[model samples]
Every structure is written in structure tokens, then in C-alpha cells.
Target: MFDCIDWVNLPTFFSMLVARSTIAPVLAAATETEPEAESSVVLAGVLLSLVAIYFASKIGGEICARINLPPVLGDLVGGVVVGISALNLLVFPDSGALGSDSLIMSILQSTSSLTPEALQVTFEAQSEVISVLSELGVVILLFEIGLESELSELIKYGPQAAIVAVVGVVLPFTLGTMGLIAFFGVATIPAIFAGAALTATSIGITAKVLAEIGRLSSKEGQIIIGAAVLDDVLGIIILAVVASLVKTGEIEVMNIIYLTISAGAFLVGTIVLGRLLGPYFVALVKELKTRGPLLISALIFAFLLSYVAAAIQLEAILGAFAAGLVLGETEIQEELEKQVIPISDMLVPIFFVVVGARTDLAVLDPTVPSNRAGLAIAAFLIVVAIVGKVVTGFTVFGQPDIKRLGIGVGMIPRGEVGLVFAGVGAASGVLSDSLQAAVIVMVILTTFIAPPWLRIVFNDSDRLETVQEE
Candidate 1:
């Protein structure tokens, strides 16, 4: 009978009659009853994963040094072993495509589920945040690379550097691209992906080798590093064009022509314009009275280049790399480096760990359905990747140079670039999931294995060159 009381007067009646509001206490009590441990547990796990990745990279990098591998290679493999696919993927199963009890698949699934769908969505959202963090990590990485570049040495060995870089990038790109067509019968999109992967020369390993032998400042060392930078710029542009074409399914003759002409032309234009404009821009910074302008200018140019590259259907990394080159040629280069280095030191390792965390360590078992194709492709691509670069080393325009070959071998590993391709290809659907796995494996192998192989090749070639001179 009391339920018939009028509700319409509740607001006015409460205001008139009540000395204090009851709503606040009721809301606080409800919140207090909710389980806060769930949120804490998830955050704690993410933090621990990040910490594990950090030490793994550092320890793995040291191991690489002892074994004569490029730390980049180690970082790449290390990341694959513990990445999103390996660690985080265990919690996810391609939307329940795999059985729950699969031994390898249960690693990430052990966390107690409060609710199935809610938990899955949370995991996916976490992955997305980590991916975004990786992007920021990349920016810091470039800053570090920019800092490592010694302009004085680059200028001294400029021609040799350009020559080596040119042959090194072009040959592997062509060979790898063609291999997709020849051996795999893969279409243009896939071929382009294979080619783009080859365009990168993992400098982390090369830089380490140079540092060890006291040649990091020598004629050979300077040229190799400089060219690797150029190769990165060009590779990124190619990646953009290829990705665009793949997405559009329109590989017209004009598209090919456009990609070819614009690639070199853009590089040339960027260099000429950047050099001519850099000094003036630095003067602007000087006039502005802001000591941080160099950093600002570098960042602006990097973004502008990224914008321009995307507008032309190229990747932003290409623009970032080009910006680094432009900055390398300026007096503010040193200043920019000083400003950016510490930031890189702190942030770049995070990017590397994030990268490691994203790598899906799950190999395509032959027993698994549709995995044989993936494994076969992975193996084929690995050989094509290695042989392609090694052969490119032998393509010198001058004398029979084993030293050049060794340098080319040293430049073979793909590192982040390959991952970018596999990721983009998979996301774009040009690469099937299995195909993506294959590509990732191929990328990991090339990145992890090439450094020590190159070291051996470099040593052998050094002896051969010495004998030839005698």
C-alpha cells in the first residue's frame, strides 16, 4: 500500500525536508564493494612483462656480442621469443580458433578468467596500447641513431659510402623481389614485401662490429654506416609505395614508373633542399633565442617528410630517416644529437622491448592445419633473404672486392623493417595469418643469424684481401 506514495514530489520534498543528502554515502558504499584486485593484477602483469623484455634485450644483446652477433639480431629474436604473439597471444587464440588444451597455446591462457569476453577485450586493448608505445619508441630510436652518426667522418668518406650503400640496397631489393616471383610464384604485393625486407641493413650489428675492431672511424666503417642510413630512407619509401599498391590492388605501369622515378628523385630533392634550407633554419632558431629549436626543427622536418611520403604513398619511416640525413648535414646536427640522445637512451630501449613483446614466438607446427605452407615459406624466404644480400655484395662496379662483399653480408639483416612489412601485410590482408607467421620467422632468422655469419665472412674476406695485396 505504501508503494502508491507519489514520486513526483521526491526532489522538492527531499530538498525541503532533508538536513543532508543520502546519495553520496550510497554511491561510496557501492564503489567500496567492487573488486579492485582485478585491475591491480592486470597492471602488475603488464609491468612484469615489460621488465622481463628489458632485461632480456640487455642480456641478449650482451650474448650477441660474445657470440659475434649483431645485438639488433639478438633483440629481434629475443623479441620474437617473448612478444605479443608468444606471451600475449597465449591469452588470445585467434578468437577461439584453437582448442583450449593445446600445450603451446595455454601459456597466456593460464590467467583466471573473471569473464571470457571482458577479459579478451581487455587483452586486445592492452596490445593496442603497447603497439602505440612501440611507435613512440621508434622515434626515440631514430634520435639515438642520429646521435651516433659522426658528421665529420661521414663527410670524409661520402663517395665510398654512397657507392656501397647504393649497390647494397638495390641488388638485394631486386633479387629478393624476383625470388618471390621465381621460387614462390608469389604475386607482386608479396614480392614487394620480400624486396622491402631486404632493403634494410640492420645497423645495430654493423655498428657493434665496427666499435669492436677500432674501424668504426675508418674509411670502410664510415661509408658502411652512412649508406645504411640511406638504405633505410629508401627502403621506407619503397615500403609505403608497396603497401599502398597492395591495399589498392592497382599496380599499373604508371604506378611502377612513379615509384621508380620518385624514389630517387625524392631522395635527391630532400638532400638538396634540406642542406640548402638547414643552415637558414638553424639561423631562425638562433634568432628565435630558443635553444631547443634544433630539436623542434628536426621534429618538424621529420613529420613533414612523413607527411610528404604518405601523400606520395610511402611509409613515414622513410621520411624520418631522410630527416635524420638532412640533420646530419647541418651544424645543428651535433646540437640536435645532444638534445635527442638522452631521450633516446631512456625511451629507445622501451621501443625495443615493446617490439620483442609483440613478436609471436609460436612456430607453425607441421602437425597443425595449414602450417606446412607457412613453415615452407618461412624457410624459403630465409634463404632468399640471406643469399640475396650476399650475392649483392659481389655486384661491385670496381675491382673484385671481397671486402665489399663482406660489408654487404654485414648489411644483410632486416630488423624492424621486416617486422613492419609482416605486420602491415597481415593487417592489410595481403598476407594470410600463416603467411604473416612465415614472414615473421623469416625476419627473425635473418635478423638474429646474419650478424655472426657476417662476422665470419668479414674475417675470412679480410685474410683473402691481405693475401691478394701480397
Candidate 2:
């Protein structure tokens, strides 16, 4: 039945109809029409991009789930399929104008030349909307994670967690910096930037994997979670230091110290202070007659913390996480989770898909000399990143019966944090395109490998008994 339809001619038929019916009338009426027409075009583009993202992510995720793989992996692949690199079916337009003669406008009149800035304005507007939604999605995700966590767990495992985090950061940073320097002959600053990108474990990916495998409450989960949080704090400080180095060409010890203090204070102070003030805020909100007041108030708190974190030169997600820590201790913890999960389910996919879309797989092709270099560096970094993180699991020696391999594997995924680091470096010109691509490859490989390894390590009853007996 589908073969009866002429797919190739369908687009031409629609184009002719649109040109004859819509574009012709719009152009003819332009002299009498208000400015709203142009705004509508931009709104249409933004809406279209969002619709594409949703369907692409949904289909991709479903496919991956059917294969017993992480759906997030599929979401990334889906974005790549429609992104500028491949199908180019989706348009995240550049900062150029949409002239009447442009591709979009030309659909109606192939030769008609209209206003110069029309398409550019619309594209910019669409881009801004997508950007805001992406940020909000990640912010909410961190906040939700914080809600599920207890501060006491972090406190109890503080020593081992610190060792895990410190070793995790140090080894990867060293290997990444040295490996890139040796392999690519890159400058110290660029090498450092690459190393910094490798240091942070993406707590989000690790936690999700643990949750999926039903080990989120296990002892290894506690250690891995605690270390990942600390690693995030360290990552923030490292990012600031790298940014400063790129801008000033000199590393400022005082600035690094200040950033460290600020990030530490935000985490410690927010949790402690939020815990103290949480009940009163909850009590005040309990008086509201509105539906889902607890959730609304909780989100407001999260957004506030996220804002503060951004203002203080930290990632908004950190503030969001802090908000979760505070809110998790409140009387309404379970209610908050109930409200937030559905929202997270919708938004988190957006963040992951956008991240995937940003990745251009073409850059990893070894046929191109620069890209070949990047691929080589990426290969080196992947090995270093895995081994460096795996070693941290041994740092858990003090804790008996803990699955060291599981903890190590749990800390392996670099995920979003690594991307954030590479993005910053790339934006600053410290990381050349190839180096940035390499970092991305490292991030992708680490993220892809860690989860399955974790599942295997966790499910090995024989290994578990051997370790327990030993």
C-alpha cells in the first residue's frame, strides 16, 4: 500500500501547493500585513525543531531499549541522524538572514528576493528558545538527583570518597595532559585543558545505571555517588582555573583557591543551611491552596540555587543539586520526588539529545589529517581515562566487602561534565578543533563503556563471593 504512493514527487507537489497558496498570498499581502508575519515564521521554525527532537529521541530511545542498551545512547544516535552532519533534516540555522531568495523563502518563489534579515531573525529567536529549554532540562535533572541523595551518606563516606575523588581527578588529569602532550605535541595549556576534561565523572550517567540495575542503594553506589559529587566540585574549580589560564596566560593560585573555596562553600553551606531552613519553607508552602505547591516551591528553590551558582561562577547544576540536598531532608521529600520524576522524564531526554546533536561524528574520521590526530588522541585518552578511574576503586580498600571493580567502573563515565569542559576549552581557543574532537571521543567512549562494565561487575556472583570471602 505504501509503495503505491509517490514519495519523491510528494515533496514537489506540496512545494507547488505551498508556493501557489501560501507564499504568493503572503508576499502579495506583505505591504498591508503587520510585523507579526515574520515573527510567526520564526516561531514555526522553533516549533518544528522541538517536534523533530521529540520524535527523534522517542524513536531512538525505544530502539535502544529494545536491544537492552541504555536509551540515552539511542537518543544521541537519533540526534546525530537528523543533525547538520548527517541528514541535515533539522535546521539549527546560523546567525544569517532568511532573505526571500533564501532556501526557506525560496521554496515559495525560487527567484523572489525579499527582506534580508527576515530568516536570520527567526533563526536566532528559535536558537535562543532551544538553548533556554536545554539549560532548564539539565538543571532540573541535577536537582532531582540531589533529592534522591542524603547528605549523611556523603558525610559518612567522606574520607574514602575524598580519596576516590582525588585519585580519580589526579590520575586522569595527569594521564590526559601527559598523553596528549606526548602523542600530539600540544602546548601545556591545551594539554591541561584536555586533562581537566577527563577528570570529572558524570554522576548523572553512573547514578542512572545504578538505578537501572537496582544497585543504587548498595555500598558501592554510596561511595561512587559521594566521589562523583566531590569530583563535580573539583571539576568546577579546574574549569575556572583553565578558563583563567586561557584568558591571562598565567595560572593564578589565589584565583584557584578562591574558586575552590566558593564551590566548597556552596556545596557545604547550601546543604547545611538549606537543611536548617528547609522545614520553615516547607511549612510556609504547606499553607498554599494551589495544586502541587510543594513541587512548585521546590522547583523555585532549585532555580534560585542554580542562579546563585551561576552568579558565583559555578555550574547551575551544582546549585540545582544543592537545592535537591536541602529539599530531600524536608517533610515533603517523597511528594517532591513524585512530582519531579515526570518532569525529569520529559526534559532530561532533551538535554541528552541536544548534547548528541552537538557531536559531529565526521570529525572522528581518520581520513582527515587533523581529525586523524584527534582520533589518535581520543584513543589514548580513552585508555587513560578508563585505567585512571578503575584505579580509584582500589582506594576503597578500607571498606570491606565493597565491590572495588564496581565502584571503579561506576566512576568511569565522563558524560556531560567532560563535554562541558571541552566546550569551555574550545570556546576559549585553548582547545583547537581536533583536540576538542578528541576530548569528545574520549567522553563518548568512556560513557558508552562504563555502564555495561558496571552491570557485568555488579552481577557477577562468583566474583562477589570471592571478594567477600577474601
Candidate 3:
């Protein structure tokens, strides 16, 4: 009977059964492996993005440095060139860009086995990673600024700084809000949001410029830094109030009070507590035997405070700045500052470049039918943004012979801060397309103009002072 059934055929039938038994496990393994493969693709995208950012920053920075401009401006320019407005090499999802819109994504797709769906997921993941890194860059930057600043000087100029902050907030807000309502005929909520946008002062850009020019420790620089810090706190409060208005159609008094009080308390408490704990911190770092014990420990402290600040609904950069101020009072401040520079060099350009990259210059294109009205409104906002902050320089009562113009110009660049306001307004649907474009244009112009303008103002002031000294 076995011979009749064909003995050789029995082995083939047995092998088929074995193959069927192994198929399920093989599929399961592949299913598990897919996520890892996706992760690798995301990482590769991020690596390429960084490469573009570093290249743009260096090239733009080099050109700007060569032309007697702030190298920071070059970083911004570099960002614009590689960003959504130009090459599309460093596009972001938050900017209403598709994965197909990014050249980097295209390159990734051509080189890898990424499917259409995988490309979308990888693009978002990569953008988010870059965004976080950019945020961290600014935090490190503020921390470095704190280290370089003299806390005593900042305190001494606190009152003057406070006045500048108050004026800077009230004037631009009042003018921009009313101007839009009267001139542009915008709705009340959108006008309020735009006004609030103008209230921002990008301390990062101003501080970086001041440092590059070796004026960071000057009296005016101290006042500018102090005022900018205060402006940030006030800006946060206003943003909360407006964002609340947008969502609920009413102001939230309790929320506003909470933000105000918490901001004030956080800044003051962090500084006071940080000072008291500074010696202990230094002592702890001294005991660690690691190669970068001091630097690593300082970063840990900064990151902790940054997290705390974020948890409390404040800007993390504020906490980083506070940490710097605290540790700045310690004995190892000088050594720590030296160690932090290389880190700053690597990270800070990412912040500036990302800010530039996120900025879409297409909004300013008058050829676009919708942009015409926006360009007109943008003109008005640009004027208001410049004048509103510029007038604050005159508000400093006791500081005779201060570079009042430089102080005002330093406060002009809204930089990434204004963009936050615009983004929030757009997200809430409170901003019309024209109004949003206007806000963006105002931001872009002020950001690009202020660096060079501030440089000129300071350069002129330096020359005048030299003549006076002579």
C-alpha cells in the first residue's frame, strides 16, 4: 500500500506542512521589525536636517561676518534660503507643509524603502524633533546670557528696566490694536491679537547681537536685557488673556492673575533660592570625578528649572535664564562660562536658523491677490512696531547719555516671539488670512531690520562716545 501511494511523494507532502507551520512566526517577526525600520528612517531624516541647518548657519554666518553684519543675521538668512520660502529643504508640519513639500523627504524617499504613509509619519516626527532641539537651543542661549550678565547690575537697573517693559507693552499694544480697528477695519479679537503680537521683544536676538559686539555688559545692555526679560513676562500674560478671549470669547481673570503671580514668583524665587543653593551646587559638582562634572551638573540644574518653568505654564527659557543668574553668582562662574561656549556654538545657531526657516517670505509676495491688503496692513504694523518700542527708550528717566536709540532698536526685533502670537491667533481662527500675513511680515521685517539697525545705532554711539572722550 505504501509503494502504491508513492514513497517519494510523502516527503514533499511533509515539507509543505512544515512550511505552513513557520509562516505565522515569520510574518509576526516582520510586523515587529517594521517599527524599528520606521524609527531608523526618522533618525536619518533628522540627521540630514541638522546637516542642512549647520551648513546654512555657517555659510550665512560667514557671509554676514564678512560684510560687517551680525553673523546671527546670516544664520537667519541661511534659514530663509533653505526653508519653506526658498529651497524647501527644511520644511515643518506646523507651517502647513506636506511631506511631499520637503526636498529632504524626497531625498529620503528616493534613497530608502519608505512608502507614502511612512514618509508622512517620518516627516512629522523629524520636524517635531528639530523643533524641540531648537527650543532647547534657545534655553541654552538664555542660560549663557545669564552667566555673562551681572545680576547686581540687572537689579540696580531693574526699575528703569521695568518702566521700559511697561511702556514697550502698552504703547505697541495700544497703537497696533487701535490702528487695525480704525484703519484696517479688522475685528476686535484679531486686532487685539495683532496688538499683543507687537508687544514682544526677542531678547535672544538682541542679546546675541550685544554679545557679538562686546556690549553685553554695558549699562545700556544691562537695562536692555532686564527690560527684555520683563517684557517676556508681560507678553506671556497678554498672550494668555488674548488666547483665552479667542477660545471662550471672554477674559479669564483668575488665569491672568495666576500667570502674573506665578511668573513673578518663579523669577524671584528661582533667583533667591538658586543663590542660596549655589555654593552647595558648586560643592556637589566639585565632588564628582567625571570629565565634565561642572558642565554636566550645571546643565542638569538648568534643565530641571526649565522643566519646572514649563510645568507652571511659563517659558522654559526664563527658568534657564534664572538658573544662569543663580550660578553666575557662584565661584566657578567663569570656568562654567568657558565650558558652555562650545555647547552654545553648536546649538544656538539651530534656534536662529529654525526661526528663520519657519518664517515664510511668500506672505510678503504682493503678486498674490490676497497679499495686497496684507502688505498695506503690514506697512502700518511695521511702523507701529518700530515706533511703539522706540519710544520706550525715551521713557528711561534717569539714564542720561544712555544709548536710547540703541535700546529702542534692540527691542524692535519680535523674532520668534511674535511668531508664537501669530501661530496662536491662526490656530484659534481669530486671525484672518490678511491679518496673519500682516503679522508675519511685521515680524520678518523687524527681525531682519533690527539686527543691522541696532548694530548701526551702537556703532554710531561708539563713534560719538569716542569723539566725546577725545
For model 3, which pairs clash?
Answer: none
User: Per-residue lDDT for 34 in model 3?
Assistant: 67
TM-score of 2: 0.84
The residue-by-residue lDDT of candidate 3 on 344-412, one tens digit each, is 998999999999999999998889999999999999999999999999888887888798988888899
TM-score of each: 0.68, 0.84, 0.93
Please write out the lDDT profile of model 2 over residues 1-470, one tens digit for every residue. 89897898999988888879977777778866433335566566556667778888999889977877667777777877766557554434331223332233333223333244444455456666776787898888888878887777767888888999999999999888887778779999999999999898988878877877777667788889889988998998888888888899888899888888898888889988998898899889979999888888888899999999999888888899889888888888888898999999888777777766666677778888889878888888888999999999998866776888888999999987888887788778788878888898998788778876787888795566879999
Residue range with the least summed lDDT across 10 consecutive positions in model 3: 30-39
Worst 10 residues of 1 by lDDT: 95-104
Question: Which is the leading candidate under lDDT?
Answer: 3
Top candidate when judged by TM-score against the true structure: 3
Q: Supply the global lDDT for candidate 1.
A: 0.63
